[model samples]
Target: MVGNPDEPHCVSHLHPETAMDQIIPFDPERMIWGSAPALIYLEIAVRVGVIWIWTIVLLRWVGGRSISQMSVVEFLLVIALGSAVGDPMFQADVPLLYGMLTILLVVLADKAVDHAFRYWTTAKRLVDGRPTEILREGHLSHAGLDKKGIGPTEVMEMLRRAGVRNLGQVEYAYMEPSGTVSTFLYDQPRPGLTIVPPLELRRLPAPDALSGACCTSCGLVRATADGTCAECGATEVTRAERLESREISSA
Candidate 1:
């Protein structure tokens, strides 16, 4: 929009000559949506048919995992496919064969990446990344937490979403590549480190009552209060080991 005479400052003053930038070139020919030749239309039809059927079959073979828990590669594959197919579908300037070639290339690249990931550890790490261990032995992994930029509250929120009350109840919690956390709750409770804080402890066994002690620094519970914390290594001992309620992690 052009600036008003009285409200001149309302306009962008970056360009000295506002009119020069404001002037847009319009082509009369651009208004025309010309039709293509029969051969070109046939090419588009064949390309679309092949790519559509190929995409459906490939996606079906890949299964629901691609949609449900998409890895980085899977997500990229989807986007590239969309971009490749979309341009050819509507853009007449983009040749039908060119679009088909683009789709095929994307699909082949996806397969290649998949094959590499299956066989090569380095490639797998590059594509899917190493799964971050957020919880281990009932204790939150400090390095894991720092790497993911998440804290006790965030971990507790994940546990809550997973329908867990205590970290002692979980043996392992992994931050997967697809951004979903996989938590494994133990059948029996044990004295281990917990990510759940004191204020928000839920229906959990009391630390002192059970075979565990709470860490003075990070609140990770262990088997005993006398020893250093497995999580923070704090020596200060106060084992108020009652299980608390849960709070959604603000982080």
Candidate 2:
């Protein structure tokens, strides 16, 4: 027959076990329908139903960002849910209805929170919380930072990562629900290479400037103010200030 050569029936069964082979003979009662074939099938159906319903409901309530923004408690809940579902999925004795009920309870609880978040402003603010306004009108708000349990140093580090040296560069800044500090640059834009001002040499650092130049292999250019390159294990190697300066001047 013109059919799959690798099909189960297409392969020949070995005659018997050899001296080198270790075989565990199959029990027809255990391998085939077993004692609870009907229940086994029912378990499959229930697990599938729970998984399908929960997947959609969870996504709706938790939101797309939950995958990225899951907190410690949220992560533990996810792990527990997986374990709770596993027993019902594999065991034939466990009623599928019980498993489905558990899943439904979680889904209902999630939906309640989702509804509150959408309809009740106070409830939403209490649970989902609001983004911390870190900067306003180019000024860093110390009160905002303090409220979010973040320090000035951390804010500065975040700003530096956002390619901004001074607070004035940012028109607005907020600590996102995902724990990332989001920055909104002013009309001038943060002084860096961006899509609108592609290939701008203004931000290029001078050869003598420690922050601008980096090692070719490791890209560790910035060191301490004491003149030490800690990044690439090369203390003597300085930035290509002359090249950068020339390029910027020409630009």
The whole-model C-alpha lDDT of candidate 1 against the native structure comes to 0.61
Worst 10 residues of 2 by lDDT: 190-199
TM-scores for all predictions: 0.54, 0.41
C-alpha lDDT (0 to 100) for residue 183 of candidate 1? 88
List, residue by residue over 110-195, the lDDT tens digit for candidate 1.
78778887888898765566678888766678888777666766667777677665566678899876667898866666544344
lDDT of 2 by residue, 66-119 (tens): 444663224434754676577667655455555565566555656665676678
lDDT of 1 at 198: 41
Kindly report the root-mean-square deviation of model 1 from the true structure over all alpha carbons.
Answer: 12.3
Model 2, residue 120: what's the lDDT?
A: 88
**After TM-score superposition, what is the CA distance of residue 204 in candidate 2 from its true location, in Å?**
19
Clash totals, every prediction: 8, 3
